[model samples]
Target: MALPERNNEGFLENAWQWDKATAEVIAAESGISLTDDHWEIIGLLREFYKQHEMSPPSNRLFVKAVKEILGEDKGNSIYLMQLFPGTPAKTACRIAGLPRPTNCL
Candidate 1:
């Protein structure tokens, strides 16, 4: 299958183009070997985008949402950082085929 189109930052240009394969490609490009835990966050990010019409604007807000949905253990910043490394919200959004968080730089 053809690769989905992506922006300069490697986010999918069209969110509808996202799929598990595409997400794996993006994750691989980012040096991530996706785990079940990573997929959990990606699914949550996609759902969050569907409801909010945007990626969470800040890490704090993302963490809060995760806490509310997945509980405190997964919602903590350190755990998220461990999963996504540099910037959990931005990295997960990219892998999830969602737009970059407006507040992220």
Candidate 2:
């Protein structure tokens, strides 16, 4: 029931690292182009974490999110999968600068 510890390298080592400046570090490491849509999702993830203090479930990540802010139309998992297939859920969390999720383990 516990969450995974972030990479020893340090979670959110990228854009949001330990502080807001860490987001720059994350940007450099991600090597992927983060667009406005991506920022929208990441910001939502941060807000979700702030409210729940937990990562979203991978299974319903897109579904759960879209309904809340951007609406159900944007809740497709395909976009998330296409965007960060290598890490999909995990990398999304990384880009969002959140701690690793429990299911990711």
Which numbered prediction scores highest in lDDT against the true structure?
Answer: 1
Candidate 2 lDDT by residue in tens digits, 1-105:
222334673464333334334544564576767767767777777888888877676646645675567776666777766655655656667767787766774
User: Can you write out model 1's per-residue Cα lDDT over 1-90, one digit (the tens) per residue?
Assistant: 677888889888899889999988888988999999999999999999898888999888989999999999999999999999898899
Give candidate 2 regions above 4 Å deviation.
Answer: 1-6, 13-21
Model 2 / residue 103 / CA error / Å: 0.3
Query: For all the candidates, what are their Cα RMSDs to the real structure?
Result: 0.9, 6.1
- TM-score, prediction 2: 0.69
If scored against the real structure, what TM-score would every candidate get?
0.95, 0.69
| Clashing pairs for predicted structure model 2, backbone only | 14-25, 14-26, 15-22, 15-23, 15-26, 16-22, 16-23
Please identify model 1 stretches exceeding 4 Å from their true place: none
| C-alpha lDDT of candidate 2 relative to the true structure | 0.62
